[model samples]
Target: MKEYLALFVIIAVFLYLTYTIASLPGSDGLPGNGGYISDEVWYVTSARNILHDFFKTPANSPYYTTTLDCLTNESRIVKEYVNINAVTVTGNVKCYIRRGFPYPDKEGILSYYNFEHPPLAKYVIGLMEAIHDEPLFWRIPSMVLGAATLILVFLSARRVTGNLWALAATALMIFDNTFRAMSGIAMLDIYLAFFTALLVYLHLSGRLLGVGTALGLAASVKYSGVFPLFGLAYLYGRRGVWGFVAVFLMAMSVFTLVNMPIAGQLGIQRWVHEILAAISWHTTSRPPGPIASNPLDWLCMHNSFALYTSPDIYASGTPAYLVALVYALYKRDDVSILYLSTYGGYWLVYLLGNHTLYSFYTTHFSPLAHILIARLLSDIARRK
Candidate 1:
C-alpha cells in the first residue's frame, strides 16, 4: 500500500510538471513573438512534407522532391510549393523564396529535404503534425517524452537510494530550466535525452534487450547517443559480450528502418553519401554569426546558450554538475563510478569535437547529475 501510494504521488507530480511545461506561453509552433525557432521551421516543414508524401503517394512517390526555385515567403509554403511569384535574390545565401517564408514545398510536400539529422525525430514531429497541424500539437511529443524521462529517473533513483532521494532528484530535474525549455519545444534533443535515460535504466535493471532497443532508439534520434554504448561496453564486458553484440545489431537495424524511406529511395550508396555530406557540412560550415562556446566555458557555464530571451531561458547545469562531480569522486562506488565514467566519456566527445558547443548538449549529462546528487544526499542523511 505504501509503495503504491509513493508511485502514485510520483506519477501525479510528473503529470503536473508536464502539464505546466506544455502550457507555457510559446509552446505553440509559430514564428515571431516567442514562436518556434528557425530550426523548428525546418523540422515542422520536414514532418509535414513526409506525412503528405506518405498519405498522398505512399506507394511510388519520391521520398523528397528536389528544391524548386520558388517565390514568396509565407507559412503556407510549409504545406505547398508555389512557383507563381517573382523571385528576388536578397542576400549571399541566394533566397529564391521571400523572407519569413518557410519555403520549397511543391503540392503540399516539402521541396527540399533535410538528411542532415536522423529521421526519427522528424518522423515523430511529422506524426504530431499529421494528428493536428498546430504548434502545441507539434510540441506534444517532446513534452510527453520529457515527462517519461523524469519517471525513469525517479524509478532508477529509487532503486539505488530510496523514495526520498528519488523525489529529490526528480524535483531537480523537473525544475531544470534547460530540460523544461527543451521539453516544451519541438526539438530533437529531448528525445535523445529520454532514450538515453531509458538505456541507462534498462542496463541497470539487467534487461539486455531493452537496453539494445533503447540504445537503438536513442541513436536514431541523434548520433550523440552512440557515446553511451562505450560505457555499456565497459560495464557489461566479456561476460556480456553477446548481449553487447545484440545491442549493436539492434541499433543498426533501428537506424536502417528509421531511414529506409529516404535510404531506399536514394539507394544505399547515395544514402551513405548524403549522410557523409551532412557530417561534412557540420564539420566545415560555420553559422553566419556563431553563438558558441568552448568546451571548458560551456562546462563552467561561462557562456550558456539562451533558448529564450524574454522569459530568460538559459541552459546551465554547472551547479548540479559540480555537486555531482564532487559526490562521485568522494563515493567512488559502483554506481558513482559508472555514472561518472559514462558522463566523462560523453563529455569527452563534445570536448574534442570540432562543432559548436550549444548549451542543450548538457541534456545528455542532466540525468547522470541528478542521480549522483540524489545518491550523495541520501548518503549524507544516512551518516547523520
Candidate 2:
C-alpha cells in the first residue's frame, strides 16, 4: 500500500511539473507548430523530412512550414530554386499543410540532412509526426518515454534500497534540470537516457538479452552509449571472454538492425559508409563553441547548455546530488565508482582529441547515479 502511494505521488509530481513548465512563456515558435527548443529545430525537422522521404505521409493534411512557397511560371521567377534540407527542390511548392514533416530531400538520401546520427529516434519522432506534424507532436514521444523512465528509475532503485529510496531517486530525477529539460525537448539525449536507464535496470536485474538490447538501442541513439556496451560486456566477462565478444556482437547486431532502414534506402554499401562517416563525425571535434563544454565540466554541473529561454532551461547536473555522489565514492562505494567511472570514457574522448563536449551528455548516466546515490543514503539510514 505504501509503495502504491509513493508511486502515485511521484506520478502526480511529474505531471504537475511538466504542465507548469510547458505553460511558461517560452519561445512558442510560429503559431500552430509549437515551440522549437534547443535542437528541436534540427531533430524535429529531420523527423518530418524522414516521414516525407520514407512515406510521403501525413499527406495533404494541415501542417505548416516556414519554407517559403516557390513562385512558379505564373510568377515569372523562371527557374529559381529553393535549397531545402540541402537538396534542390525544383518547382516544388507543396502545401505545408500536410500534417507531416517537410517535403523529402530531393536526393532521396532520406537523411534529411541530419544523417550523422542513427535514425531510430527520428523514426520514433516520425511516429508522432505521422499523427500530427507539429512541434508538440514531435515532442510528445520524448515526454511519454521520460514518464516511463521514472518507473525504470523506481524499479532499478528498488533493487538497491527498496521502495522508499527508490521513490527518493525518482523525485531527484523529476527535479534535476538536465533530466527535466531533455524530457520535454525533441532531441536525441532523452532517448539515449531512456535506454541508459534501461541498461541500469537490466544490469541490476541480471537479464542478458535485455542488457544487450538496451546497449544497442542506447548506442543507436548516441555513440556515448557505446561506453556502457563495453562496460556491460566486461561485467558479463565473469562468464568468459568469448561470452564478452558474443555479447558485444549481439549488441552491435541490434545496432545494425536499427540502421537497416537507412540501408534499405541508401543500399548496404552506402549505409556502411554512412555509419563509418558518422563515427568519424562523432570522434572529431571543431573549435570550442559557446555551447560545448568539456566532459569534466559536467562533474559539478558547470557550463550548462541553454535549451530554452524566457526563464532559461539550462541543461546541467544537480550540484548537491553530485556532491553526494563524490562523497559516496570517497567511502569506497563500489556502485558509485562503477557508475562514475563511465565518465572515463568521455575523458578518453577528450584526451583523444575531441575537446568540444556538452554537459547535457551527462543525461547518459545521471539517472543511474541518482538511483545509486539514493540507495547509498538509504543504506546509511539503515546503519544508523
Clashes per model (N, Cα, C within 3 A): 6, 6
Model 1: residue 24 alpha-carbon error in angstroms: 5.5
Residue 280's lDDT in candidate 2: 78
For residue 323, give model 1's deviation from the true position in Å. Answer: 2.0
Provide TM-scores for the models: 0.78, 0.84
**Largest TM-score belongs to which candidate?**
2
Estimate, for each residue in 7-81, the C-alpha lDDT of model 1 and write its tens digit: 567656655655564555552222232335425656766666565554342211112222344323431222232
Tens digits of per-residue lDDT, candidate 2, 43-155, equal: 77677676777656642334333234532343221111144322112234443322333333233323454777888898888778777655556667777777778888888
Candidate 1, poorest ten consecutive residues by summed lDDT:
57-66
lDDT per model, in order?
Answer: 0.65, 0.68
lDDT of 1 at 78: 26
lDDT of model 1, residue 137: 74
Candidate 1: stretches off by over 4 Å? 1-34, 54-112, 238-240, 281-285, 288-290, 329-342, 345-355
> lDDT of model 1 at residue 360?
72
How far does residue 290 in candidate 1 sit from its true spot (Å)? 5.2
